[model samples]
Target: EPEVTQTPSHQVTQMGQEVILRCVPISNHLYFYWYRQILGQKVEFLVSFYNNEISEKSEIFDDQFSVERPDGSNFTLKIRSTKLEDSAMYFCASSEGQGSHQPQHFGDGTRLSIL
Candidate 1:
Protein backbone atom coordinates (compact mmCIF):
# COMPACT_ATOMS: atom_id res chain seq x y z
CA GLU A 1 0.00 0.00 0.00
CA PRO A 2 1.08 3.56 -0.69
CA GLU A 3 1.90 5.84 2.18
CA VAL A 4 3.08 9.37 2.97
CA THR A 5 6.78 9.87 3.50
CA GLN A 6 8.56 12.74 5.28
CA THR A 7 12.22 13.65 5.18
CA PRO A 8 14.68 14.72 7.85
CA SER A 9 12.74 12.83 10.53
CA HIS A 10 14.14 15.24 13.09
CA GLN A 11 15.15 18.88 12.88
CA VAL A 12 16.74 21.23 15.39
CA THR A 13 16.69 24.97 14.83
CA GLN A 14 17.05 28.14 16.80
CA MET A 15 14.17 30.45 17.41
CA GLY A 16 13.63 33.04 14.63
CA GLN A 17 15.24 30.74 12.08
CA GLU A 18 13.34 29.32 9.12
CA VAL A 19 12.51 25.67 8.51
CA ILE A 20 10.95 23.65 5.77
CA LEU A 21 9.22 20.30 6.36
CA ARG A 22 8.92 18.06 3.36
CA CYS A 23 6.56 15.23 2.45
CA VAL A 24 5.55 12.95 -0.41
CA PRO A 25 2.08 11.48 -0.34
CA ILE A 26 0.57 8.53 -2.13
CA SER A 27 0.83 9.10 -5.86
CA ASN A 28 -2.89 9.06 -6.49
CA HIS A 29 -3.95 11.26 -3.60
CA LEU A 30 -5.48 14.57 -4.58
CA TYR A 31 -5.63 16.51 -1.32
CA PHE A 32 -2.67 17.31 0.86
CA TYR A 33 -2.58 18.82 4.35
CA TRP A 34 -0.29 19.88 7.17
CA TYR A 35 -0.99 19.38 10.85
CA ARG A 36 0.99 19.84 14.03
CA GLN A 37 0.80 18.45 17.54
CA ILE A 38 2.37 20.36 20.38
CA LEU A 39 3.54 18.35 23.33
CA GLY A 40 0.53 17.47 25.49
CA GLN A 41 -1.75 19.24 23.06
CA LYS A 42 -4.18 18.00 20.46
CA VAL A 43 -3.31 17.70 16.82
CA GLU A 44 -4.16 20.94 15.08
CA PHE A 45 -4.89 21.38 11.45
CA LEU A 46 -2.75 23.93 9.69
CA VAL A 47 -3.68 23.98 6.04
CA SER A 48 -4.95 21.92 3.13
CA PHE A 49 -3.96 22.20 -0.50
CA TYR A 50 -5.85 20.96 -3.54
CA ASN A 51 -5.83 21.61 -7.24
CA ASN A 52 -2.58 23.53 -6.77
CA GLU A 53 -4.19 26.10 -4.47
CA ILE A 54 -5.05 26.38 -0.83
CA SER A 55 -8.47 24.88 -0.23
CA GLU A 56 -8.71 25.55 3.49
CA LYS A 57 -6.60 26.81 6.34
CA SER A 58 -6.84 27.19 10.07
CA GLU A 59 -5.99 30.33 12.01
CA ILE A 60 -2.68 28.78 12.90
CA PHE A 61 -1.72 29.10 9.28
CA ASP A 62 -0.93 32.79 9.60
CA ASP A 63 1.36 34.92 7.48
CA GLN A 64 4.33 33.22 9.08
CA PHE A 65 3.42 29.89 7.53
CA SER A 66 3.08 28.73 3.96
CA VAL A 67 2.71 25.51 1.94
CA GLU A 68 3.70 24.59 -1.58
CA ARG A 69 4.04 21.69 -3.99
CA PRO A 70 7.15 22.68 -5.87
CA ASP A 71 7.76 19.48 -7.87
CA GLY A 72 4.29 18.00 -8.29
CA SER A 73 5.18 15.14 -5.97
CA ASN A 74 6.62 16.86 -2.94
CA PHE A 75 4.63 19.01 -0.55
CA THR A 76 6.49 21.44 1.67
CA LEU A 77 5.62 23.58 4.66
CA LYS A 78 7.76 26.63 5.22
CA ILE A 79 7.81 28.50 8.48
CA ARG A 80 9.38 31.89 7.95
CA SER A 81 10.22 32.54 11.58
CA THR A 82 10.26 29.78 14.11
CA LYS A 83 9.45 30.32 17.76
CA LEU A 84 9.82 28.29 20.91
CA GLU A 85 6.13 27.55 20.86
CA ASP A 86 6.49 26.23 17.34
CA SER A 87 8.25 23.16 18.59
CA ALA A 88 6.10 20.21 17.72
CA MET A 89 5.66 17.13 15.58
CA TYR A 90 4.48 18.26 12.17
CA PHE A 91 2.59 15.66 10.20
CA CYS A 92 1.88 15.53 6.50
CA ALA A 93 -1.25 13.81 5.22
CA SER A 94 -3.04 13.16 1.97
CA SER A 95 -6.38 11.81 0.84
CA GLU A 96 -7.92 10.63 -2.37
CA GLY A 97 -10.83 13.06 -1.98
CA GLN A 98 -12.22 15.73 0.31
CA GLY A 99 -14.68 15.41 3.24
CA SER A 100 -14.60 13.36 6.40
CA HIS A 101 -15.60 10.24 4.54
CA GLN A 102 -12.28 9.95 2.81
CA PRO A 103 -9.48 8.48 4.84
CA GLN A 104 -6.33 10.58 5.18
CA HIS A 105 -3.01 8.80 5.34
CA PHE A 106 -0.31 10.34 7.51
CA GLY A 107 3.45 10.35 7.46
CA ASP A 108 5.74 9.50 10.36
CA GLY A 109 6.15 13.27 10.84
CA THR A 110 9.05 15.62 11.35
CA ARG A 111 9.81 16.45 14.94
CA LEU A 112 10.86 20.09 15.01
CA SER A 113 12.72 21.42 17.98
CA ILE A 114 13.07 25.17 18.33
CA LEU A 115 15.75 26.32 20.69
Candidate 2:
Protein backbone atom coordinates (compact mmCIF):
# COMPACT_ATOMS: atom_id res chain seq x y z
CA GLU A 1 0.00 0.00 0.00
CA PRO A 2 1.10 3.59 -0.56
CA GLU A 3 2.04 5.71 2.43
CA VAL A 4 3.12 9.22 3.37
CA THR A 5 6.90 9.61 3.68
CA GLN A 6 8.96 12.29 5.41
CA THR A 7 12.65 12.97 4.98
CA PRO A 8 15.36 13.42 7.66
CA SER A 9 13.52 11.59 10.42
CA HIS A 10 15.48 13.77 12.82
CA GLN A 11 16.47 17.39 12.36
CA VAL A 12 18.45 19.74 14.59
CA THR A 13 18.53 23.50 14.21
CA GLN A 14 19.23 26.57 16.28
CA MET A 15 16.46 28.91 17.34
CA GLY A 16 15.74 31.65 14.80
CA GLN A 17 17.10 29.56 11.96
CA GLU A 18 15.15 28.30 8.98
CA VAL A 19 14.16 24.75 8.21
CA ILE A 20 12.16 23.04 5.53
CA LEU A 21 10.57 19.69 6.27
CA ARG A 22 9.67 17.61 3.26
CA CYS A 23 6.94 15.05 2.69
CA VAL A 24 5.70 12.81 -0.08
CA PRO A 25 2.00 12.24 0.40
CA ILE A 26 0.24 9.13 -0.86
CA SER A 27 -0.51 9.28 -4.53
CA ASN A 28 -4.16 9.53 -5.62
CA HIS A 29 -5.02 11.22 -2.35
CA LEU A 30 -6.59 14.65 -2.64
CA TYR A 31 -6.49 16.14 0.84
CA PHE A 32 -3.16 16.85 2.51
CA TYR A 33 -2.43 18.12 5.98
CA TRP A 34 0.32 18.84 8.46
CA TYR A 35 0.15 18.21 12.17
CA ARG A 36 2.53 18.36 15.13
CA GLN A 37 2.91 16.56 18.42
CA ILE A 38 4.87 18.07 21.21
CA LEU A 39 6.64 15.50 23.39
CA GLY A 40 3.66 14.91 25.66
CA GLN A 41 0.89 16.81 23.95
CA LYS A 42 -1.97 15.94 21.70
CA VAL A 43 -1.61 15.82 17.93
CA GLU A 44 -2.37 19.37 16.83
CA PHE A 45 -3.45 20.31 13.36
CA LEU A 46 -1.40 22.96 11.67
CA VAL A 47 -2.92 23.33 8.25
CA SER A 48 -4.77 21.49 5.52
CA PHE A 49 -4.34 22.16 1.80
CA TYR A 50 -6.42 21.12 -1.18
CA ASN A 51 -6.92 22.32 -4.75
CA ASN A 52 -3.58 24.16 -4.37
CA GLU A 53 -4.66 26.49 -1.57
CA ILE A 54 -5.24 26.24 2.15
CA SER A 55 -8.52 24.70 3.11
CA GLU A 56 -8.19 24.98 6.87
CA LYS A 57 -5.55 26.26 9.27
CA SER A 58 -5.18 26.46 13.00
CA GLU A 59 -4.01 29.45 15.02
CA ILE A 60 -0.70 27.70 15.44
CA PHE A 61 -0.01 28.31 11.78
CA ASP A 62 1.43 31.77 12.13
CA ASP A 63 3.66 34.01 10.08
CA GLN A 64 6.64 31.83 10.84
CA PHE A 65 5.28 28.93 8.88
CA SER A 66 4.38 28.16 5.29
CA VAL A 67 3.52 25.14 3.13
CA GLU A 68 3.72 24.23 -0.51
CA ARG A 69 3.04 21.52 -3.01
CA PRO A 70 6.13 22.02 -5.14
CA ASP A 71 5.18 19.15 -7.40
CA GLY A 72 2.59 16.48 -7.98
CA SER A 73 3.73 14.28 -5.11
CA ASN A 74 5.86 16.41 -2.82
CA PHE A 75 4.51 18.62 -0.06
CA THR A 76 6.71 20.83 2.06
CA LEU A 77 6.52 22.89 5.24
CA LYS A 78 8.91 25.72 5.97
CA ILE A 79 9.62 27.52 9.21
CA ARG A 80 11.20 30.83 8.34
CA SER A 81 12.22 31.43 11.94
CA THR A 82 12.29 28.53 14.30
CA LYS A 83 11.81 28.74 18.04
CA LEU A 84 12.52 26.40 20.92
CA GLU A 85 8.81 25.75 21.24
CA ASP A 86 8.84 24.57 17.64
CA SER A 87 10.50 21.33 18.66
CA ALA A 88 8.12 18.51 17.93
CA MET A 89 7.27 15.62 15.66
CA TYR A 90 5.98 17.00 12.37
CA PHE A 91 3.59 14.63 10.61
CA CYS A 92 2.33 14.73 7.07
CA ALA A 93 -1.03 13.20 6.30
CA SER A 94 -3.35 12.56 3.39
CA SER A 95 -6.82 11.25 2.69
CA GLU A 96 -9.16 10.51 -0.17
CA GLY A 97 -12.18 12.77 -0.42
CA GLN A 98 -14.60 9.98 -1.22
CA GLY A 99 -16.27 10.80 2.09
CA SER A 100 -16.10 13.61 4.63
CA HIS A 101 -15.35 11.09 7.34
CA GLN A 102 -12.46 9.51 5.50
CA PRO A 103 -9.58 8.96 7.87
CA GLN A 104 -6.18 10.44 7.24
CA HIS A 105 -3.00 8.36 7.14
CA PHE A 106 0.16 9.82 8.64
CA GLY A 107 3.86 9.52 8.02
CA ASP A 108 6.27 8.24 10.66
CA GLY A 109 7.19 11.91 11.21
CA THR A 110 10.20 14.19 11.27
CA ARG A 111 11.39 14.96 14.76
CA LEU A 112 12.46 18.59 14.83
CA SER A 113 14.84 19.71 17.54
CA ILE A 114 15.61 23.32 18.28
CA LEU A 115 18.64 24.53 20.14
Candidate 3:
Protein backbone atom coordinates (compact mmCIF):
# COMPACT_ATOMS: atom_id res chain seq x y z
CA GLU A 1 0.00 0.00 0.00
CA PRO A 2 1.13 3.54 -0.64
CA GLU A 3 1.82 5.85 2.29
CA VAL A 4 3.19 9.26 3.07
CA THR A 5 6.64 9.56 4.65
CA GLN A 6 7.80 12.36 6.90
CA THR A 7 11.34 13.03 8.08
CA PRO A 8 12.50 14.06 11.53
CA SER A 9 9.26 13.01 13.16
CA HIS A 10 10.07 15.45 15.94
CA GLN A 11 11.72 18.83 15.91
CA VAL A 12 12.70 21.31 18.62
CA THR A 13 13.43 24.94 17.94
CA GLN A 14 13.68 28.21 19.78
CA MET A 15 11.29 31.08 19.39
CA GLY A 16 12.23 33.36 16.49
CA GLN A 17 14.07 30.57 14.73
CA GLU A 18 13.16 28.89 11.50
CA VAL A 19 11.92 25.32 11.08
CA ILE A 20 11.31 23.15 8.08
CA LEU A 21 9.11 20.07 8.08
CA ARG A 22 9.50 17.56 5.27
CA CYS A 23 7.31 14.89 3.73
CA VAL A 24 7.02 12.58 0.73
CA PRO A 25 3.52 11.63 -0.27
CA ILE A 26 2.44 8.64 -2.33
CA SER A 27 4.16 8.73 -5.70
CA ASN A 28 0.99 8.82 -7.78
CA HIS A 29 -0.76 11.47 -5.72
CA LEU A 30 -1.40 14.75 -7.50
CA TYR A 31 -2.47 17.12 -4.75
CA PHE A 32 -0.45 18.01 -1.65
CA TYR A 33 -1.41 19.94 1.46
CA TRP A 34 -0.19 21.10 4.85
CA TYR A 35 -2.17 21.28 8.03
CA ARG A 36 -1.46 21.80 11.71
CA GLN A 37 -3.06 21.10 15.03
CA ILE A 38 -2.28 22.92 18.22
CA LEU A 39 -2.45 20.93 21.40
CA GLY A 40 -6.06 20.39 22.39
CA GLN A 41 -7.27 22.23 19.28
CA LYS A 42 -8.87 21.07 16.10
CA VAL A 43 -6.73 20.59 13.03
CA GLU A 44 -6.44 23.62 10.79
CA PHE A 45 -5.73 23.73 7.11
CA LEU A 46 -2.63 25.66 6.09
CA VAL A 47 -2.09 25.36 2.39
CA SER A 48 -2.60 23.18 -0.67
CA PHE A 49 -0.34 22.83 -3.68
CA TYR A 50 -1.15 21.34 -7.08
CA ASN A 51 0.20 21.53 -10.57
CA ASN A 52 3.27 23.27 -9.17
CA GLU A 53 1.23 26.17 -7.84
CA ILE A 54 -0.72 27.01 -4.74
CA SER A 55 -4.29 25.90 -5.24
CA GLU A 56 -5.66 27.01 -1.91
CA LYS A 57 -4.57 28.41 1.41
CA SER A 58 -6.03 29.22 4.77
CA GLU A 59 -5.42 32.35 6.79
CA ILE A 60 -3.06 30.35 8.95
CA PHE A 61 -0.65 30.29 6.02
CA ASP A 62 0.74 33.78 6.48
CA ASP A 63 3.99 35.48 5.65
CA GLN A 64 5.69 33.35 8.25
CA PHE A 65 4.77 30.17 6.46
CA SER A 66 5.57 28.74 3.05
CA VAL A 67 5.41 25.44 1.19
CA GLU A 68 7.46 24.01 -1.64
CA ARG A 69 8.23 20.86 -3.60
CA PRO A 70 11.83 21.40 -4.49
CA ASP A 71 12.70 17.96 -5.85
CA GLY A 72 9.43 16.74 -7.32
CA SER A 73 9.16 14.21 -4.52
CA ASN A 74 9.62 15.88 -1.18
CA PHE A 75 7.19 18.53 0.05
CA THR A 76 8.36 20.97 2.66
CA LEU A 77 6.82 23.52 5.02
CA LYS A 78 8.99 26.32 6.29
CA ILE A 79 8.15 28.61 9.14
CA ARG A 80 10.35 31.66 8.76
CA SER A 81 9.99 32.82 12.34
CA THR A 82 8.87 30.34 14.88
CA LYS A 83 6.83 31.31 17.88
CA LEU A 84 5.48 29.56 20.95
CA GLU A 85 2.14 29.41 19.19
CA ASP A 86 3.74 27.48 16.38
CA SER A 87 4.23 24.43 18.57
CA ALA A 88 1.98 21.84 17.06
CA MET A 89 1.82 18.67 15.04
CA TYR A 90 2.10 19.52 11.35
CA PHE A 91 0.59 17.05 8.92
CA CYS A 92 1.35 16.46 5.26
CA ALA A 93 -1.34 15.02 3.04
CA SER A 94 -1.86 14.06 -0.57
CA SER A 95 -4.61 12.81 -2.82
CA GLU A 96 -4.99 11.44 -6.33
CA GLY A 97 -7.30 14.31 -7.18
CA GLN A 98 -8.61 17.54 -5.72
CA GLY A 99 -11.93 18.27 -3.96
CA SER A 100 -13.65 16.81 -0.93
CA HIS A 101 -14.68 13.70 -2.82
CA GLN A 102 -11.15 12.36 -3.13
CA PRO A 103 -9.65 10.67 -0.14
CA GLN A 104 -6.69 12.57 1.25
CA HIS A 105 -3.95 10.44 2.75
CA PHE A 106 -1.96 11.90 5.62
CA GLY A 107 1.50 11.29 7.03
CA ASP A 108 1.98 10.49 10.69
CA GLY A 109 2.96 14.13 11.25
CA THR A 110 5.91 16.10 12.59
CA ARG A 111 5.68 17.52 16.05
CA LEU A 112 7.24 20.96 16.28
CA SER A 113 8.27 22.25 19.67
CA ILE A 114 9.23 25.85 20.28
CA LEU A 115 11.09 26.97 23.34
Q: lDDT (CA) for every model shown?
A: 0.95, 0.96, 0.94
Residues 15-104 of candidate 2 have per-residue lDDT tens digits of 999999999998989999999999999999999999999999999999999999999989999999999999999999999875669999
Clashing pairs in 2: none
TM-score of model number 1: 0.96
The predicted structure with the larger lDDT, 1 or 3, is 1
**Global Cα lDDT for candidate 2:** 0.96
How many collisions between residues are there in candidate 1?
0
lDDT of 3: 0.94
Which residue window of length 10 is worst by lDDT in model 1?
Answer: 96-105
Per-residue lDDT for 1-115 in model 1, tens only?
8889998899999999999999999999999999999999999999999999999999999999999999979999999999999999999999996676898899999999999
lDDT of 1: 0.95
Q: 15-91 in candidate 3: lDDT tens per residue?
A: 99999999999999999999999999999999999998899999889999988999979999999999999999999
